[model samples]
Target: MANTTALLFFSLAAFAACSPSTCTFIPSTNATTTNYPGSSFIKTSAYPYNISVLSEVPIATICTSPTGNRTAELACARIYIDAIDEQLAFLYARRLGYAAVAGASKFATNTSLNDPSRNDVVAAGMAAKVLKYGATEAAGAVMGGEGCMIYAALKYEVETIQEECNNKFTVDVERVCK
Candidate 1:
C-alpha cells in the first residue's frame, strides 16, 4: 500500500519535475499497461467535501493501473494536463468528447469505409463507464500505435479525469450517457 502511494507520488512528481531537456526520447520498451480509471468517477462530487476528505483527491481518483513505470508516466505530463476547474464541466467535457469521437469513428461515419452502417446507437446505448473505456481504447489504437509515452499518458489522463465528474444521477444506461 505504501509502495503504491510512493510510486504515484514519484510518477506524478517526475512528471511535474520534467523539463524539456529532462524529458527525452523514451525507448520502445516502455510499459503498456492500460488499467486506467473506470466510469464510476462521478462519486467524487456526489458526497460531501469537508475537512475530513480534504487531504484526499477522492479515493475514486486512485485508478487501477495494471503495471506501469515512471518512463511513460513522466512523459505524459508534457503532452496532457487534466486539472479541470469544475467538476460538472469535467463531466460535460467527457460526454462531449465521447460523443464527438464515437460520431467520427469509422463505424459511425460513412465517409471512412464507404459503409452505410453508422452505428451511433452503440455510443448512445453505452453506460457512462463503457463510454470512457471504449473511447480510451479507440483513441489509444489510433494514437498509440507506436506505444509512445505521451500517447499512453494521454490515455491514462483521459480516463482518470473523466472518472472525477458528476454521475448521471443514476446508472440507467438509457439516460446515462444521453
Candidate 2:
C-alpha cells in the first residue's frame, strides 16, 4: 500500500509537470473602478496603457564554409536581415496593440490573420505552387511567393484593426503609416 501510494504520487506529479496551460500574450485589461462623490455613475476603464511582447531575434554569424564561405556569408546576411525586419514588425504590431502569433502565421499575417485556417491554407497553397510550378523560375518565383505573405498580413491588419475599434473611434491609417 505504501509503495503504491508513492508511485501514484510520482505519476501525478509528472503529469502535472507535463500539462499544457493557456498563456496570454496580452496583459489583462482588468482595472479597479473609481467613483467620485459628485458622480452617480461609476467609471469603468482599464489602465491607459498597452502591453506588447516581442520574440528574440537570432543573430547571424560566419560559420566555417561547408560549400564555400560566399554561400554561408550570403545566407547569414539574409537571416540577419530577416530577423531585423521581424523585430521591426513586432514593434509596429505592439505599438498598434496586436499580439504576435507563433509559427509561420506570425510572419505571414498582418494582424494574427483573423482566421487561423487562412494562414494554413494560404501557406500550403503558396508553398505547393512554388515547389511545383516555380521550381525553375528561381528569383522571380521567390519574390512572388514572398509577395503573397505580405498580402495576407496586410489584409489581416486592416480587417482585424477595423473590427476591434469602437464605433466612435476613428482610425487614420495614413497617420499610423507615417
Candidate 3:
C-alpha cells in the first residue's frame, strides 16, 4: 500500500512537471458574439487541434475514496477546481470567438473536440488521482494535506486549456480564417 501510494504521488508530480503545457487554455476570439462578452464563438475552421482520443479512464476510480480515504477530500477540491476551470475555459474560449455547440452536431461537425465538458471530466479524474496518490502518500495525511496538489493541478490545467484555445484561435481563426 505504501509503495503504491508513493508511486502514484511521484507519477503525478512528474506528469505535472513534465506536461505543464499540454492543458493550458489560451484565449481565442474565433467564436464570439454580443450575446455574451466573455464568450467566443468557435467555428469549425477555427479548430486548431488534429483531434486525438488519448486514453480512457473511469472517473469513479479516481473520485472515490481508496483504502486511505484521502481521495474523498481530493475529489471535493478537484470538483471545485473543475467547475472553475471549465467555466473559465468556456467563457474564455467564447470570449475569444469560439461559440458553444452541444456536441459534434451539424453546428459543430467541423469543430475539433466539440465537447468542452470532456476536458473537464478528464481534469476532474486527474485531480482525483493526484489527491489519492500524491496528497496522501506525500503528506501522510488527507484533506488539508492534499490541498497543494489540487491547486497545482488546477493551475496547470487552466493555463494549458487557455493556451491551447489561444494558439488555435491565433492560427486558425485570426490568422487563416480571418
TM-score against truth, every candidate: 0.18, 0.23, 0.19
Best candidate per lDDT, number?
Answer: 2
Q: Candidate 1 or 3, higher TM-score?
A: 3
Look at candidate 2 and give me any clashing residue pairs: 109-153, 110-153
Comparing 1 with 2 on lDDT, the higher-scoring candidate is 2
Top of the candidates by TM-score:
2
| Cα lDDT tens digits for candidate 1, 95-142 | 444543432332222233211122233333333334465555444333
Ranking by lDDT: 2, 3, 1
List candidate 1 stretches off by more than 4 Å: 1-85, 106-108, 111-178
Give per-residue lDDT, candidate 2, residue 47.
17
TM-score attained by model 3: 0.19
TM-score: the better of candidates 2 and 3: 2
Candidate 1 vs candidate 3: the lDDT winner is 3
> What is the C-alpha lDDT profile of model 3 across 1-178, one tens digit per residue?
9999999999987665434233333334543353232224332221112211112212334455556677575865565454444444544455323222221121223344323344445445655665775453323322212333233333333344434422232111111110
lDDT of 1: 0.33
